[model samples]
Target: PAGAGQDQTFRADDEPEHGDLIVTEAGVLKVLHTPGHASNHLCFLLVDQQLLFSGDHIMQGSTVVINPPDGDMKAYIESLYELLAESVRYIAPAHGFLMGHPEAVIDFLITHRLSREHKVARALGALTPVDLKALTAKAYDDVPAAIHGLAARSALAHLLKLEAEHRAFREGDLWHAIHES
Candidate 1:
Protein backbone atom coordinates (compact mmCIF):
# COMPACT_ATOMS: atom_id res chain seq x y z
CA PRO A 1 0.00 0.00 0.00
CA ALA A 2 3.07 2.15 -0.26
CA GLY A 3 2.33 4.76 -2.91
CA ALA A 4 5.83 4.79 -4.28
CA GLY A 5 6.40 7.15 -7.21
CA GLN A 6 2.93 8.60 -6.67
CA ASP A 7 4.45 11.91 -5.74
CA GLN A 8 7.34 12.30 -8.16
CA THR A 9 7.21 16.06 -7.78
CA PHE A 10 8.67 15.87 -4.29
CA ARG A 11 12.42 16.29 -4.11
CA ALA A 12 14.84 16.16 -1.22
CA ASP A 13 16.83 19.36 -0.78
CA ASP A 14 19.44 17.70 1.45
CA GLU A 15 20.33 14.15 2.38
CA PRO A 16 21.02 13.83 6.09
CA GLU A 17 23.26 11.04 7.34
CA HIS A 18 23.26 9.35 10.71
CA GLY A 19 24.55 11.54 13.57
CA ASP A 20 24.06 14.67 11.45
CA LEU A 21 22.34 17.54 13.20
CA ILE A 22 19.84 19.91 11.66
CA VAL A 23 18.91 23.06 13.53
CA THR A 24 15.23 23.94 13.35
CA GLU A 25 12.91 26.34 15.15
CA ALA A 26 11.64 23.57 17.39
CA GLY A 27 15.07 22.23 18.21
CA VAL A 28 18.19 20.61 16.84
CA LEU A 29 17.28 17.31 15.19
CA LYS A 30 19.78 14.48 15.29
CA VAL A 31 19.50 12.13 12.35
CA LEU A 32 19.44 8.43 13.14
CA HIS A 33 19.75 5.98 10.26
CA THR A 34 17.44 3.19 11.31
CA PRO A 35 17.31 0.56 8.61
CA GLY A 36 15.06 -2.47 9.00
CA HIS A 37 11.53 -1.78 7.81
CA ALA A 38 13.28 -0.15 4.88
CA SER A 39 16.94 0.31 3.99
CA ASN A 40 16.63 4.08 3.78
CA HIS A 41 14.52 4.59 6.89
CA LEU A 42 15.59 7.47 9.13
CA CYS A 43 14.49 8.66 12.57
CA PHE A 44 14.95 12.20 13.71
CA LEU A 45 15.59 13.03 17.35
CA LEU A 46 14.72 16.40 18.83
CA VAL A 47 17.83 16.79 20.98
CA ASP A 48 16.63 19.67 23.09
CA GLN A 49 13.18 18.21 23.74
CA GLN A 50 14.43 14.63 24.15
CA LEU A 51 11.85 13.53 21.62
CA LEU A 52 12.37 10.94 18.92
CA PHE A 53 10.55 10.91 15.59
CA SER A 54 10.58 7.16 15.01
CA GLY A 55 9.11 7.15 11.51
CA ASP A 56 8.47 3.52 10.42
CA HIS A 57 10.96 2.04 12.87
CA ILE A 58 8.44 1.90 15.67
CA MET A 59 4.66 2.24 15.33
CA GLN A 60 1.92 2.74 17.89
CA GLY A 61 -0.45 -0.08 17.03
CA SER A 62 1.62 -2.69 15.20
CA THR A 63 5.13 -4.02 14.84
CA VAL A 64 7.08 -2.85 11.84
CA VAL A 65 7.48 -5.43 9.04
CA ILE A 66 10.92 -6.67 8.13
CA ASN A 67 10.65 -7.95 4.58
CA PRO A 68 13.95 -9.42 3.37
CA PRO A 69 16.47 -8.03 0.92
CA ASP A 70 15.69 -4.49 2.05
CA GLY A 71 14.43 -5.33 5.53
CA ASP A 72 17.03 -6.82 7.87
CA MET A 73 15.78 -8.24 11.14
CA LYS A 74 19.26 -8.21 12.65
CA ALA A 75 19.73 -4.60 11.70
CA TYR A 76 16.26 -3.79 13.01
CA ILE A 77 17.07 -5.23 16.43
CA GLU A 78 20.46 -3.55 16.49
CA SER A 79 18.89 -0.22 15.61
CA LEU A 80 16.51 -0.55 18.54
CA TYR A 81 19.46 -1.12 20.84
CA GLU A 82 21.12 1.93 19.36
CA LEU A 83 18.16 4.05 20.36
CA LEU A 84 18.58 2.95 23.96
CA ALA A 85 21.86 4.87 23.99
CA GLU A 86 20.05 8.07 23.13
CA SER A 87 18.43 10.30 25.72
CA VAL A 88 14.85 10.13 24.53
CA ARG A 89 11.90 10.61 26.83
CA TYR A 90 9.12 10.48 24.26
CA ILE A 91 8.49 8.91 20.89
CA ALA A 92 6.61 10.54 18.03
CA PRO A 93 5.91 7.63 15.77
CA ALA A 94 4.92 8.30 12.21
CA HIS A 95 1.77 6.17 12.39
CA GLY A 96 0.76 6.55 16.02
CA PHE A 97 0.16 8.95 18.87
CA LEU A 98 3.02 10.33 20.90
CA MET A 99 4.30 7.89 23.47
CA GLY A 100 6.07 8.43 26.81
CA HIS A 101 8.85 6.34 28.37
CA PRO A 102 10.86 5.91 25.18
CA GLU A 103 13.29 3.50 26.80
CA ALA A 104 10.48 1.26 27.95
CA VAL A 105 8.95 1.31 24.49
CA ILE A 106 12.26 0.37 22.89
CA ASP A 107 12.81 -2.40 25.39
CA PHE A 108 9.34 -3.82 24.78
CA LEU A 109 9.80 -3.86 21.02
CA ILE A 110 13.21 -5.53 21.29
CA THR A 111 11.97 -8.11 23.76
CA HIS A 112 8.92 -8.88 21.66
CA ARG A 113 11.00 -9.37 18.52
CA LEU A 114 13.49 -11.61 20.35
CA SER A 115 10.66 -13.62 21.85
CA ARG A 116 9.21 -14.13 18.36
CA GLU A 117 12.66 -15.14 17.17
CA HIS A 118 12.83 -17.71 19.92
CA LYS A 119 9.48 -19.07 18.81
CA VAL A 120 10.77 -19.29 15.26
CA ALA A 121 13.84 -21.20 16.49
CA ARG A 122 11.69 -23.60 18.46
CA ALA A 123 9.48 -24.15 15.46
CA LEU A 124 12.55 -24.76 13.33
CA GLY A 125 13.89 -27.31 15.80
CA ALA A 126 10.58 -29.15 15.83
CA LEU A 127 9.97 -28.91 12.10
CA THR A 128 13.42 -29.19 10.65
CA PRO A 129 13.73 -29.79 6.92
CA VAL A 130 10.42 -27.98 6.49
CA ASP A 131 9.49 -25.32 3.97
CA LEU A 132 8.96 -21.66 4.87
CA LYS A 133 5.16 -21.89 4.71
CA ALA A 134 4.94 -24.88 7.04
CA LEU A 135 7.50 -23.37 9.44
CA THR A 136 5.62 -20.10 9.59
CA ALA A 137 2.44 -21.93 10.53
CA LYS A 138 4.18 -23.59 13.45
CA ALA A 139 6.05 -20.52 14.66
CA TYR A 140 3.18 -18.06 14.33
CA ASP A 141 0.45 -20.29 15.68
CA ASP A 142 -0.28 -17.65 18.31
CA VAL A 143 -1.53 -15.22 15.67
CA PRO A 144 -4.63 -15.46 13.51
CA ALA A 145 -4.36 -17.68 10.44
CA ALA A 146 -5.54 -14.90 8.12
CA ILE A 147 -2.24 -13.01 8.53
CA HIS A 148 0.09 -15.97 8.08
CA GLY A 149 1.17 -14.64 4.73
CA LEU A 150 2.53 -11.50 6.35
CA ALA A 151 3.84 -13.51 9.27
CA ALA A 152 5.83 -15.66 6.87
CA ARG A 153 7.75 -12.60 5.74
CA SER A 154 8.79 -11.79 9.31
CA ALA A 155 9.54 -15.45 9.95
CA LEU A 156 11.84 -15.52 6.99
CA ALA A 157 13.59 -12.48 8.33
CA HIS A 158 14.07 -14.22 11.65
CA LEU A 159 15.37 -17.34 9.93
CA LEU A 160 17.85 -15.21 8.02
CA LYS A 161 19.07 -13.77 11.27
CA LEU A 162 19.42 -17.22 12.74
CA GLU A 163 21.33 -18.34 9.69
CA ALA A 164 23.67 -15.40 10.07
CA GLU A 165 24.32 -16.49 13.65
CA HIS A 166 25.08 -20.05 12.48
CA ARG A 167 21.99 -21.39 14.17
CA ALA A 168 20.01 -22.33 11.04
CA PHE A 169 20.50 -23.25 7.41
CA ARG A 170 18.41 -23.67 4.28
CA GLU A 171 18.58 -26.24 1.54
CA GLY A 172 16.58 -25.33 -1.55
CA ASP A 173 13.08 -24.52 -0.28
CA LEU A 174 13.55 -26.38 2.99
CA TRP A 175 15.07 -24.98 6.18
CA HIS A 176 17.10 -26.95 8.72
CA ALA A 177 18.25 -26.08 12.22
CA ILE A 178 21.93 -26.46 13.00
CA HIS A 179 22.22 -28.32 16.26
CA GLU A 180 25.33 -27.75 18.30
CA SER A 181 27.12 -30.74 19.76
Candidate 2:
Protein backbone atom coordinates (compact mmCIF):
# COMPACT_ATOMS: atom_id res chain seq x y z
CA PRO A 1 0.00 0.00 0.00
CA ALA A 2 1.09 3.61 -0.63
CA GLY A 3 2.07 5.76 2.35
CA ALA A 4 2.87 9.33 3.35
CA GLY A 5 5.81 10.30 5.57
CA GLN A 6 6.01 12.43 8.71
CA ASP A 7 5.08 16.11 8.55
CA GLN A 8 7.94 18.51 7.82
CA THR A 9 8.09 22.08 6.54
CA PHE A 10 9.99 21.18 3.36
CA ARG A 11 10.21 17.96 1.32
CA ALA A 12 11.42 15.54 3.91
CA ASP A 13 14.49 13.52 2.99
CA ASP A 14 13.31 10.67 5.18
CA GLU A 15 10.46 10.05 2.71
CA PRO A 16 10.68 6.72 0.97
CA GLU A 17 11.43 6.59 -2.73
CA HIS A 18 8.83 4.50 -4.57
CA GLY A 19 11.01 3.60 -7.54
CA ASP A 20 11.45 5.93 -10.53
CA LEU A 21 9.12 3.63 -12.48
CA ILE A 22 6.13 1.58 -11.40
CA VAL A 23 5.13 -1.46 -13.45
CA THR A 24 1.62 -2.81 -13.13
CA GLU A 25 -0.84 -4.91 -15.14
CA ALA A 26 -1.63 -1.82 -17.17
CA GLY A 27 1.87 -0.75 -18.24
CA VAL A 28 5.15 0.77 -17.12
CA LEU A 29 4.35 4.21 -15.73
CA LYS A 30 7.05 6.86 -15.37
CA VAL A 31 6.75 9.09 -12.30
CA LEU A 32 7.14 12.78 -12.99
CA HIS A 33 7.61 15.09 -10.03
CA THR A 34 5.45 18.16 -10.59
CA PRO A 35 5.85 19.99 -7.27
CA GLY A 36 3.91 23.24 -6.94
CA HIS A 37 0.52 22.78 -5.33
CA ALA A 38 2.54 20.95 -2.70
CA SER A 39 6.13 19.84 -2.62
CA ASN A 40 4.84 16.29 -2.95
CA HIS A 41 2.83 16.88 -6.16
CA LEU A 42 3.27 14.29 -8.89
CA CYS A 43 2.15 13.41 -12.43
CA PHE A 44 2.37 10.01 -14.03
CA LEU A 45 2.80 9.02 -17.64
CA LEU A 46 1.20 5.84 -18.94
CA VAL A 47 3.86 4.23 -21.12
CA ASP A 48 1.52 2.28 -23.37
CA GLN A 49 -1.00 5.00 -24.29
CA GLN A 50 1.11 8.14 -23.57
CA LEU A 51 -1.67 9.26 -21.24
CA LEU A 52 -0.84 11.70 -18.43
CA PHE A 53 -2.33 11.47 -14.96
CA SER A 54 -2.30 15.12 -13.88
CA GLY A 55 -2.97 15.05 -10.16
CA ASP A 56 -4.29 18.51 -9.18
CA HIS A 57 -1.96 20.28 -11.61
CA ILE A 58 -4.29 20.62 -14.56
CA MET A 59 -7.78 20.20 -13.24
CA GLN A 60 -10.77 20.24 -15.60
CA GLY A 61 -12.86 22.46 -13.36
CA SER A 62 -11.63 25.33 -11.16
CA THR A 63 -8.02 26.42 -11.42
CA VAL A 64 -5.80 25.35 -8.55
CA VAL A 65 -3.99 28.15 -6.79
CA ILE A 66 -0.22 27.87 -6.37
CA ASN A 67 -0.08 27.90 -2.56
CA PRO A 68 3.23 29.43 -1.46
CA PRO A 69 5.73 28.97 1.41
CA ASP A 70 5.68 25.35 0.27
CA GLY A 71 4.29 25.91 -3.24
CA ASP A 72 6.56 28.27 -5.14
CA MET A 73 4.95 30.38 -7.87
CA LYS A 74 8.16 30.24 -9.90
CA ALA A 75 8.25 26.47 -9.62
CA TYR A 76 4.55 26.20 -10.48
CA ILE A 77 5.06 28.30 -13.63
CA GLU A 78 8.01 26.15 -14.60
CA SER A 79 5.99 23.01 -13.94
CA LEU A 80 3.25 24.22 -16.31
CA TYR A 81 5.84 24.74 -19.02
CA GLU A 82 7.24 21.31 -18.33
CA LEU A 83 3.77 19.78 -18.72
CA LEU A 84 3.34 21.57 -22.03
CA ALA A 85 6.68 20.19 -23.23
CA GLU A 86 5.59 16.61 -22.66
CA SER A 87 3.92 14.60 -25.44
CA VAL A 88 0.45 13.53 -24.34
CA ARG A 89 -3.02 13.51 -25.84
CA TYR A 90 -5.04 12.58 -22.75
CA ILE A 91 -5.01 14.20 -19.29
CA ALA A 92 -6.81 12.49 -16.40
CA PRO A 93 -6.68 14.85 -13.43
CA ALA A 94 -7.36 14.06 -9.79
CA HIS A 95 -10.28 16.48 -9.74
CA GLY A 96 -12.95 16.86 -12.42
CA PHE A 97 -13.09 14.97 -15.76
CA LEU A 98 -10.48 14.62 -18.48
CA MET A 99 -9.15 17.78 -20.03
CA GLY A 100 -10.22 17.96 -23.69
CA HIS A 101 -8.24 21.10 -24.44
CA PRO A 102 -4.95 20.99 -22.58
CA GLU A 103 -3.35 23.93 -24.38
CA ALA A 104 -6.34 26.16 -23.75
CA VAL A 105 -6.37 25.26 -20.07
CA ILE A 106 -2.66 25.94 -19.81
CA ASP A 107 -3.07 29.29 -21.54
CA PHE A 108 -5.97 30.21 -19.29
CA LEU A 109 -3.94 29.38 -16.18
CA ILE A 110 -0.93 31.38 -17.34
CA THR A 111 -3.09 34.34 -18.33
CA HIS A 112 -4.97 34.17 -15.07
CA ARG A 113 -1.75 34.47 -13.08
CA LEU A 114 -0.49 37.32 -15.25
CA SER A 115 -3.84 39.06 -14.75
CA ARG A 116 -3.47 38.73 -11.00
CA GLU A 117 0.00 40.25 -11.22
CA HIS A 118 -1.52 43.14 -13.15
CA LYS A 119 -4.19 43.58 -10.54
CA VAL A 120 -1.46 43.75 -7.90
CA ALA A 121 0.36 46.33 -9.97
CA ARG A 122 -2.78 48.44 -10.30
CA ALA A 123 -3.44 48.12 -6.61
CA LEU A 124 0.08 49.31 -5.91
CA GLY A 125 -0.52 52.39 -8.10
CA ALA A 126 -3.89 53.41 -6.66
CA LEU A 127 -3.18 53.20 -2.96
CA THR A 128 -0.59 54.12 -0.35
CA PRO A 129 0.24 52.41 2.94
CA VAL A 130 -2.03 49.38 2.33
CA ASP A 131 -1.90 46.48 4.72
CA LEU A 132 -2.11 42.81 3.68
CA LYS A 133 -5.73 42.65 4.79
CA ALA A 134 -6.80 45.79 2.89
CA LEU A 135 -4.90 45.05 -0.32
CA THR A 136 -6.09 41.47 -0.30
CA ALA A 137 -9.65 42.63 0.27
CA LYS A 138 -9.62 44.85 -2.82
CA ALA A 139 -7.66 42.42 -4.94
CA TYR A 140 -9.92 39.51 -4.12
CA ASP A 141 -13.16 41.36 -3.36
CA ASP A 142 -15.01 39.14 -5.82
CA VAL A 143 -14.53 36.16 -3.52
CA PRO A 144 -16.86 35.63 -0.56
CA ALA A 145 -15.89 37.19 2.77
CA ALA A 146 -15.86 33.81 4.44
CA ILE A 147 -12.94 32.69 2.25
CA HIS A 148 -11.26 36.07 2.38
CA GLY A 149 -8.62 34.78 4.74
CA LEU A 150 -7.48 32.24 2.18
CA ALA A 151 -7.61 34.93 -0.48
CA ALA A 152 -5.47 37.09 1.75
CA ARG A 153 -3.01 34.26 2.03
CA SER A 154 -2.81 33.99 -1.76
CA ALA A 155 -2.48 37.75 -2.06
CA LEU A 156 0.28 37.65 0.55
CA ALA A 157 1.91 34.90 -1.47
CA HIS A 158 2.01 37.24 -4.45
CA LEU A 159 3.30 40.05 -2.28
CA LEU A 160 6.05 37.91 -0.85
CA LYS A 161 7.12 36.81 -4.31
CA LEU A 162 7.03 40.37 -5.60
CA GLU A 163 9.02 41.58 -2.62
CA ALA A 164 11.67 38.96 -3.21
CA GLU A 165 11.93 40.18 -6.82
CA HIS A 166 12.32 43.79 -5.52
CA ARG A 167 9.00 44.83 -7.08
CA ALA A 168 7.37 45.44 -3.69
CA PHE A 169 8.21 46.03 -0.04
CA ARG A 170 6.45 45.39 3.24
CA GLU A 171 6.25 47.76 6.19
CA GLY A 172 4.87 45.95 9.23
CA ASP A 173 1.70 44.21 7.85
CA LEU A 174 1.41 46.53 4.87
CA TRP A 175 3.00 46.20 1.40
CA HIS A 176 3.93 49.23 -0.66
CA ALA A 177 5.16 49.49 -4.24
CA ILE A 178 8.91 50.17 -4.37
CA HIS A 179 8.58 53.10 -6.76
CA GLU A 180 6.43 55.25 -4.45
CA SER A 181 9.20 57.43 -3.09
Candidate 3:
Protein backbone atom coordinates (compact mmCIF):
# COMPACT_ATOMS: atom_id res chain seq x y z
CA PRO A 1 0.00 0.00 0.00
CA ALA A 2 3.03 2.26 0.22
CA GLY A 3 3.18 3.09 -3.49
CA ALA A 4 -0.53 2.61 -4.06
CA GLY A 5 -0.94 6.01 -5.67
CA GLN A 6 2.19 5.93 -7.79
CA ASP A 7 0.14 5.50 -10.94
CA GLN A 8 -1.76 8.70 -10.22
CA THR A 9 -0.40 12.08 -11.26
CA PHE A 10 -1.05 14.90 -8.83
CA ARG A 11 -0.09 18.56 -9.08
CA ALA A 12 0.28 21.16 -6.37
CA ASP A 13 -1.30 24.58 -6.73
CA ASP A 14 1.56 26.29 -4.92
CA GLU A 15 5.09 25.07 -4.46
CA PRO A 16 6.35 26.13 -1.05
CA GLU A 17 10.09 26.66 -0.73
CA HIS A 18 12.20 26.86 2.38
CA GLY A 19 11.30 29.64 4.86
CA ASP A 20 7.83 29.89 3.40
CA LEU A 21 5.02 30.36 5.86
CA ILE A 22 1.73 28.53 5.59
CA VAL A 23 -0.97 29.99 7.77
CA THR A 24 -3.64 27.42 8.51
CA GLU A 25 -6.65 27.53 10.83
CA ALA A 26 -4.55 25.80 13.47
CA GLY A 27 -1.43 27.99 13.37
CA VAL A 28 1.36 29.43 11.25
CA LEU A 29 3.58 26.68 9.83
CA LYS A 30 7.07 27.69 8.78
CA VAL A 31 8.72 25.49 6.20
CA LEU A 32 12.22 24.40 7.13
CA HIS A 33 14.35 22.91 4.38
CA THR A 34 15.98 20.03 6.17
CA PRO A 35 17.86 18.07 3.51
CA GLY A 36 19.90 14.85 3.89
CA HIS A 37 17.10 12.30 4.20
CA ALA A 38 16.43 13.30 0.63
CA SER A 39 17.76 16.50 -0.95
CA ASN A 40 14.38 18.19 -0.98
CA HIS A 41 13.13 17.12 2.45
CA LEU A 42 11.16 19.79 4.32
CA CYS A 43 9.99 20.03 7.92
CA PHE A 44 7.17 22.31 9.00
CA LEU A 45 7.23 24.12 12.30
CA LEU A 46 4.09 25.31 14.07
CA VAL A 47 5.31 28.72 15.21
CA ASP A 48 2.76 29.21 17.95
CA GLN A 49 3.08 25.76 19.51
CA GLN A 50 6.83 25.19 19.04
CA LEU A 51 6.01 21.87 17.40
CA LEU A 52 7.86 20.55 14.37
CA PHE A 53 6.14 18.41 11.76
CA SER A 54 9.20 16.33 11.11
CA GLY A 55 8.70 14.35 7.91
CA ASP A 56 11.30 11.58 7.91
CA HIS A 57 13.87 14.01 9.34
CA ILE A 58 13.31 12.52 12.77
CA MET A 59 11.66 9.24 13.68
CA GLN A 60 10.03 8.17 16.92
CA GLY A 61 11.42 4.71 17.66
CA SER A 62 13.68 3.82 14.72
CA THR A 63 16.37 5.65 12.76
CA VAL A 64 15.74 6.45 9.13
CA VAL A 65 17.92 4.99 6.40
CA ILE A 66 20.51 7.18 4.68
CA ASN A 67 20.66 5.75 1.17
CA PRO A 68 23.18 7.77 -0.88
CA PRO A 69 22.96 9.45 -4.29
CA ASP A 70 19.95 11.02 -2.52
CA GLY A 71 20.80 10.82 1.17
CA ASP A 72 23.91 12.66 2.40
CA MET A 73 25.03 11.82 5.90
CA LYS A 74 26.92 15.08 6.32
CA ALA A 75 23.93 17.16 5.24
CA TYR A 76 21.58 15.15 7.47
CA ILE A 77 23.79 15.72 10.48
CA GLU A 78 24.14 19.42 9.64
CA SER A 79 20.37 19.77 9.37
CA LEU A 80 20.00 18.26 12.83
CA TYR A 81 22.40 20.86 14.20
CA GLU A 82 20.42 23.59 12.49
CA LEU A 83 17.26 22.47 14.33
CA LEU A 84 18.99 23.24 17.65
CA ALA A 85 18.63 26.95 16.86
CA GLU A 86 14.88 26.61 16.60
CA SER A 87 12.40 26.71 19.47
CA VAL A 88 11.10 23.20 18.93
CA ARG A 89 9.49 21.44 21.90
CA TYR A 90 7.65 18.63 20.12
CA ILE A 91 8.29 16.56 16.98
CA ALA A 92 5.43 15.08 14.96
CA PRO A 93 7.35 12.64 12.82
CA ALA A 94 6.02 11.10 9.63
CA HIS A 95 6.01 7.73 11.30
CA GLY A 96 4.92 7.05 14.90
CA PHE A 97 3.68 9.23 17.78
CA LEU A 98 4.54 12.80 18.67
CA MET A 99 7.79 13.22 20.63
CA GLY A 100 8.75 15.69 23.36
CA HIS A 101 12.12 17.01 24.54
CA PRO A 102 13.05 18.12 21.03
CA GLU A 103 16.54 19.34 21.93
CA ALA A 104 17.45 16.13 23.70
CA VAL A 105 16.17 14.10 20.75
CA ILE A 106 18.22 16.14 18.30
CA ASP A 107 21.29 15.83 20.51
CA PHE A 108 20.87 12.09 20.78
CA LEU A 109 20.45 11.71 17.00
CA ILE A 110 23.62 13.73 16.37
CA THR A 111 25.60 11.79 18.95
CA HIS A 112 24.35 8.47 17.60
CA ARG A 113 25.30 9.33 14.02
CA LEU A 114 28.73 10.58 15.09
CA SER A 115 29.28 7.41 17.07
CA ARG A 116 28.32 5.36 14.03
CA GLU A 117 30.66 7.43 11.89
CA HIS A 118 33.47 6.75 14.31
CA LYS A 119 32.73 3.05 14.07
CA VAL A 120 32.76 3.30 10.29
CA ALA A 121 36.12 5.08 10.35
CA ARG A 122 37.56 2.49 12.69
CA ALA A 123 36.23 -0.35 10.52
CA LEU A 124 37.62 1.27 7.40
CA GLY A 125 40.98 1.73 9.06
CA ALA A 126 41.07 -1.91 10.12
CA LEU A 127 39.94 -3.16 6.73
CA THR A 128 41.42 -0.80 4.21
CA PRO A 129 40.93 -1.28 0.50
CA VAL A 130 37.74 -3.12 1.27
CA ASP A 131 34.39 -3.19 -0.49
CA LEU A 132 31.19 -1.68 0.97
CA LYS A 133 29.88 -5.06 2.03
CA ALA A 134 33.01 -5.88 4.02
CA LEU A 135 33.24 -2.44 5.57
CA THR A 136 29.58 -2.55 6.58
CA ALA A 137 30.03 -5.94 8.18
CA LYS A 138 32.93 -4.68 10.24
CA ALA A 139 31.32 -1.39 11.17
CA TYR A 140 27.78 -2.63 11.76
CA ASP A 141 28.47 -5.94 13.38
CA ASP A 142 25.94 -5.10 16.04
CA VAL A 143 23.23 -4.89 13.42
CA PRO A 144 21.44 -8.07 12.44
CA ALA A 145 22.74 -9.97 9.40
CA ALA A 146 19.36 -9.80 7.65
CA ILE A 147 19.56 -6.03 7.45
CA HIS A 148 23.17 -5.76 6.29
CA GLY A 149 21.93 -4.89 2.84
CA LEU A 150 20.14 -1.87 4.26
CA ALA A 151 23.03 -1.06 6.60
CA ALA A 152 25.42 -1.00 3.63
CA ARG A 153 23.53 1.94 2.19
CA SER A 154 24.01 4.02 5.37
CA ALA A 155 27.62 2.86 5.51
CA LEU A 156 28.14 4.17 2.00
CA ALA A 157 26.69 7.50 3.12
CA HIS A 158 29.16 7.60 6.01
CA LEU A 159 32.01 6.68 3.65
CA LEU A 160 30.98 9.48 1.31
CA LYS A 161 30.97 11.96 4.19
CA LEU A 162 34.38 10.73 5.28
CA GLU A 163 35.62 11.04 1.73
CA ALA A 164 34.33 14.60 1.54
CA GLU A 165 36.29 15.40 4.73
CA HIS A 166 39.45 13.75 3.28
CA ARG A 167 39.33 11.16 6.05
CA ALA A 168 38.75 8.36 3.56
CA PHE A 169 39.11 7.60 -0.14
CA ARG A 170 37.67 5.22 -2.69
CA GLU A 171 39.29 3.38 -5.55
CA GLY A 172 36.93 1.58 -7.89
CA ASP A 173 34.52 -0.16 -5.53
CA LEU A 174 36.94 -0.39 -2.62
CA TRP A 175 37.28 2.13 0.20
CA HIS A 176 40.48 3.13 1.98
CA ALA A 177 40.92 5.16 5.15
CA ILE A 178 43.37 8.04 5.33
CA HIS A 179 45.67 7.85 8.29
CA GLU A 180 47.59 10.85 9.65
CA SER A 181 51.33 10.43 9.74
Inter-residue clash pairs, candidate 2: none
* Separate clash counts for every candidate: 0, 0, 0
C-alpha RMSD in Å of predicted model 2 compared with the true structure = 4.6
What ranges in model 2 sit over 4 Å off? 1-19
Task: For candidate 3, report its TM-score.
Answer: 0.93
Decide which is better by TM-score, 2 or 3. Answer: 3
lDDT per residue (tens digit) for residues 72-110 in model 1: 999999999999999998999999899998888999999
Q: Rate the local accuracy (lDDT) of all candidates.
A: 0.94, 0.75, 0.94
Worst 10 residues of 2 by lDDT: 10-19
Model 1 residue 165 CA deviation (Å) reads 1.0
Q: Which stretches in model 1 have alpha-carbon errors above 4 Å?
A: 1-11
- Give per-model TM-scores: 0.94, 0.79, 0.93
Q: Give the higher-lDDT candidate: 1 or 2.
A: 1
Q: How far in Å is the alpha carbon of 98 misplaced in model 1?
A: 0.4
Q: lDDT-based ranking, best first?
A: 1, 3, 2
What's the CA error at residue 148 for candidate 3, in Å? 0.4
